[model samples]
Target: MTKAHFDDLKALVVDDNAHMRELLHALLNVLGIREVVEAADGEAGYAALAQYQPDFILTDLAMQPVDGIEFTRRVRLSPDTPNPFVPIIMVSGHTERNRVEAARDAGVTEMLAKPITTQSLFARIAEIVEHPRAFVRCDSYFGPDRRRRHGDSHSGPWLRFDDSAPDVVTI
Candidate 1:
């Protein structure tokens, strides 16, 4: 695995479930991330954002008070914000097309489905934080032959294409 530039990285994990929040925190810690903050939901997540300027954020789509999409929009559009350019990742159990599309419209950098594994989480984080513009092809994570667009400079992961993998394809 290629070494990530995670030395200066700090992350905030937001979820309604305590277990989910803790799971994300633990995963990030294992990835060598030093500063990890937890929020119960979007409201708390936003509050944390105002206080701590994290390098990245991971939030759940479904929450009690506020949902993930709105939270992401607020962060991206809010002026005088601490971390306006901070990459926001949305985690959801919902695999519905509308929810995913809405998350994209709300300015989410990436989406991770439920039962998120360490590799998938880190892969999504790395893909966006490292190469902001090069879109991930949604068809598959691995390649028959991957392609890059004009002016794109970075190379992404090369996973073994398997029919069984849950299509961690980016787009």
Candidate 2:
């Protein structure tokens, strides 16, 4: 993708570690994102969301007062949230299945493992820009559609055990 795609984007970097926040800011800059806002933790990140209204968010999984999971939940479920639809990409050193599932269930738009490289970061951003996922809301979940695959020719009830269709709302 071209740098032009990111030229006008604004991002929020939320992490308890100052070093990680700085590193993310620098990486965002290199990718042609000049307007980046940083927050010390998810609590501050939530506040910044209203003031900055960033196009997207980059948050760490672990933090005090509020972790990324809770923050993402608030962003997607809070009545007073400024921008519930804003894309959130959670970054964490922990890539365990449980942690990944938690982030996904909490409404994160994407997940990026820690020790992040420029290429990986760009790839995630590119995916967000190029193929924005439609949001789905159900009694138990309110977030992007969990299913990533589309147009699969394999038609079988085994693919999706639950025949019940989720109420989908495209954003």
Candidate 3:
């Protein structure tokens, strides 16, 4: 597969730790993303979004006052959000299933465990670019479709309420 070019993309890095921000900045630079904005925490990150209007966001999961989950939620749900559709990749040391599920529920496009590698980071970015998921809006959620796999084949009964069953007799 051909390497994807990210020279034109702008990114926002949000982490309370300065060193983590620096590391991510370096990685992003190496990936050819020259325009990067950094925020020390989620609150700052939220403000920066309006000011910088980044094409994507990489955020740490834990922070004071506001964490990455809250950050992603605001970006996706806030009325004044600069770009609700912007892709959000949450990077965190908390790899526990509950934490990961929380991030997913908050609308993160992808999650990368801490101790990130160049290859893994690149793969996530490429996945976002190559297979962008369609956004879904409902009473409780407004984010990318939660379901990752899509096909007509199913081992059990049809689950989607929108899909009509061929064997059902209409009244």
* Top candidate, metric TM-score: 3
* Pairs with steric clashes in candidate 3: none
Better of 1 and 3 by lDDT: 3
Error of 3 at 121 (Å): 0.9
Sorting all predicted structures by TM-score, with the top scorer first, yields 3, 2, 1
RMSD after Cα superposition, model 2: 7.2
Candidate 1, residue 117: CA error in Å?
1.6
lDDT of 2 by residue, 67-133 (tens): 9999999999998999878889999998999999999998999999988988999899988988889
Candidate 3 off by > 4 Å: 1-5, 152-171
Candidate 1 colliding pairs: 136-170
lDDT of 1 by residue, 39-113 (tens): 988889999988877878999999878888778767766655565567788889987999987777666778899
lDDT of 3 by residue, 58-164 (tens): 99999988999999999999989989999999999999999999999999999998899889988998888888889989877889987776554433366577544
Task: Give stretches of model 2 more than 4 Å off.
Answer: 1-5, 151-171
